[model samples]
Target chain A: MKFDFNNNIPIYIQIVEQIKTDIVAGKFKPGERLPSVRDFANETKVNPNTMQKALVELEESGLVFTERTNGKFITHDTSLINFYKQKYAEELTLTYLKRMYDIGYSLGEISKQIEQLGGNK
Target chain B: MNTILELKNLNKSFGAKKVLENINLTIPRGKIVGLLGKNGTGKSTLIKLINDLLTPTSGEVLINGKSPSVESKKIIAYLPERTYLDKSMKVAQVIKYFAEFYDNFDSQKAYKLLEELGLDVNQKLAKMSKGMQEKVQLVLVMSRKADLYILDEPLGGVDPATREYILDTILSNFNEGASVIISTHLINDIERILDDVIFINDGKIILHSECDKLRTEQGGSVDEIFRRMFRC
Candidate 1:
């Protein structure tokens, strides 16, 4: 996972966001086991306590579940993953359009830019 | 969770020079606290008083509801800035020393950490570099199953990799219900791990709060707030 830590947001929030992004993006497959908090903390260069807090948040949100005897795993519900993926896509689209609107472009012009970029892709 | 450590109206003086004045704070179990300040602040002095290296001029410092004493010392594991272990002792002998001194010292855990860090048990402390010596000291200190662990500048003069290693060891090794008070000026590096933070300047507590609450209220990281507050 990519770690882009900055001073703008708290580190634990960043961890939660990144892990959620990976799950929603299908980089970490549903039902896959997550690294133990210690291993994840070392790999991400975060404090284990901070990682534990973020994992707790994820667990509360139903994105991850602990098996008591086993470690945490991504949620096995495909519908939940799809919902998050769609929510993320919608959020990104809104962010892009909002930036273009702030630059004085109308919705029509923003759509034209999007289609042009999409064609190039 | 119980309060593991508390200071009430604590003051320290060295013959008319006041180092700390009227400091009061409580540290609860299962928390990692950052004791922060600029140079020449009373951070180290307060730490020393809690660890019983020095006596307070007034008021009291308590560990587990008792004043600083042998009982308190048994429960509090301290790592001062300077190395106190004998330089001639081998790593293996130092482990034995810890085992002999503290009932909670786990020799197996100490040996496992030493092996993980690639330290030779037969290597003499005198032959190791300053940073390696510090790591050895930290390994021994953290090997104790103490209620309170007070570390003063544990990351000083270390490279980035070793810093990460030490921080990881610290986070993983401590026991449940244990409270860690780490005193350092390396705010950015340690801020994320802190559950709460205490800012001491001119021998007074300036700010103390849960770290996330402070972050949300101030809209800045602890390092930024510290820079703004101290202007250093």
Candidate 2:
């Protein structure tokens, strides 16, 4: 729950991104109940308002839902979760490729290097 | 009222010197606002005016749409820049004193916080270090069920680790819909918790903005913006 926040960016947006990563990575199980905004804010060491905004953003994206007095819960849709996972992987891959290209490495060379690293793993 | 506090054409002076000038601001409920500035930049003066500690030369200081009076004072918990507890009183005695003095003061919550901080209730104020005393003050202030909490430099004397604890205490405590106004020169440490920020310089408010919008527009942290704006 520790956040090494970048102050240059909006704190709530960072919270949304981190929580989204956690959800997609299975740290927060599908259909799991989330903590109250206050408890979440305390855990993340952020303002409750900021945490509320982040949760609302998550809800808007259909990753979370409110059940009236029962509080918030993660969506049980495995397909939605998988979709986000794929989307995030694509984003990371594109970023890596862009950086490699900027450093004068071709896509072929980058793939070879990644394969070598993966083989060692 | 929706607005917890407001200032209209606020001005203050001391003889020939103008300490605060033509200031106007409004604070809504359920917000944590940072009143930030360099030393002697009217931050304290603005806070003092809100607390009725000093009279503004003109304009008005409104708390819940009323002037600073006994009614407003009851709902506004104030932690001044300096410690004013009786030096001879033990921590427990001070809690008792505060309980008797302020109706909203929660002695049990105060004791719990003190225990968590590992501060002995029997310890006298003079026996504790300056940082420890400040922690005690913060615990007491946050223990109160006040509508608006005005903390002046609560993190000034504490170390970095203690600063985190202090910020946590502030974030966890406080009644819902209550606003907190924290004045500090240590911008980076407190900026994350602030919903809005008021930047003052040379007796005037240079900027007041939501922290996220300001970050997006200025392309930096509030600390960086402050440093750039106030650079000599």
Per-candidate clashes come to: 0, 0
lDDT of 2 by residue, B85-202 (tens): 9989999999999999999999999999999998999999999999999999999999999999999999999999999889989998978999999999999999999999999999
Q: List the residue pairs that clash in candidate 2.
A: none
TM-score of each: 0.86, 0.96
TM-scores of the first chain across all predictions? 0.93, 0.96
lDDT (Cα, tens digit) per residue for candidate 1, span A1-121: 4365765467788889899999998999999999998788767766667789899999997999999989999999989989988999999999988888899999888888777888674
DockQ per candidate: 0.42, 0.85
Q: What is the C-alpha lDDT profile of model 1 across B43-82, one tens digit per residue?
A: 9999999988899999999888899899999999999999
Worst 10 residues of 2 chain B by lDDT: B167-176
- Stretches of candidate 2 above 4 Å error? A119-121
10 residues in a row with least lDDT, candidate 1 chain B = B168-177
All candidates' chain B TM-scores are 0.98, 0.99
The lDDT of model 2 is 0.94
